[model samples]
Target: MKWVRSKICGITRIEDGLCAAHMGADAIGLVFYEKSPRYVGLDQARSIVQAMPAFVSIVGLFVNAQAAQIKQTFDYVGLDLIQYHGDETASFCEALALPYIRALRMQPDVDIAQVAKTYVNARGILLDSYVPGLPGGTGEVFNWSLIPSLDKPLILAGGLSSTNIAQAVAQVQPWAVDVSGGVEQAKGIKSAEKITDFMQALRANR
Candidate 1:
């Protein structure tokens, strides 16, 4: 039997945070990138984190933000982990000294194996779809066939929802699956029904 963990990303409201945690999400993500439609302010992020029940991991997502900014967020939000979604170097990520995951956009020229080697300290490697101007949450699926066996845990994101989660999990068998827009009623706002449906689909598949 396989166990596929689920993460509900881009949680903004306290209700949404509680909903995701109550829906059996192993983790919940908060976007700190200002440009993202799903971005959460520091106060909002802190309140969401405070409202969450125990055992649900909180992940703080950032783009190519200044080190001071990330440090401030880490301190203020009390995140359990950090996720680097921009072109942060392995050394820079390591310097933060927080347990972190690296979001890798599956672009044509990306060397997955080499990247895995470069950030060997990442707790997991998240694979997201690549759009020319977007970092993540593009709501587009990448070619699962392009994925190769990796030495580290592989987390699949991008375009995941109740509609396709079962098939996606059956095919890739990732360490986890992350969803944002797919489970939202709008950007940064989560839909309770959609979240329940998505988790049910994933659990049934596993």
Candidate 2:
């Protein structure tokens, strides 16, 4: 619980990216998925990445995108990690030069352990809530009790905010926690005060 890292996902602006990094976020995520409201285009994402200080990772979220496109974006944005939110296969995930984390929408039949084994090359495994048609950013919490002991590092997401983050950390004790809408002023905009509060609450966990 004490060492849990935090990642502020769905960053669309350079100021938000800098705010998250300066406020002690371990990482800042950039959404490349066009369907997502928080989506950042190649030029915008590049600008954000360029302005970010070192030690704060930049993660690019892709939803079943083409291999070439992923490669191009990965190179163009100089992303530190690739987050796969759709139905990408293990080989497909590992084929890239950069490391990645596979985000699983916690559906009924999902076997977290099996997935951990299958995506052996993944740097970490992220668990998010399930919606009927969405790949990620569902903003709904799943039954954490259902998560079993696993081999890989777990990154918990879905509906995490300043209010319940401490409890979620105490319960799951994940390697890292990712939040999007939780610290937002709007769909694609971030609230610095909310981000600070969320990080402070997370740090207060013991």
Local accuracy by lDDT, each model: 0.92, 0.91
lDDT of 2 by residue, 1-206 (tens): 36999899999999999999988999999999999999999999999999999899989999999999999999998999999999998988887756899998778887778877888788888999989998888778888888778777899999999999988998999999999999999999999999999999988884
Q: What is the model-wide C-alpha lDDT for candidate 1? A: 0.92
Candidate 2's error at 57, in angstroms?
A: 0.5
TM-score of each: 0.98, 0.97
Off by over 4 Å in 1: none
> In candidate 2, how many clashes are counted?
0
Off by over 4 Å in 2: none
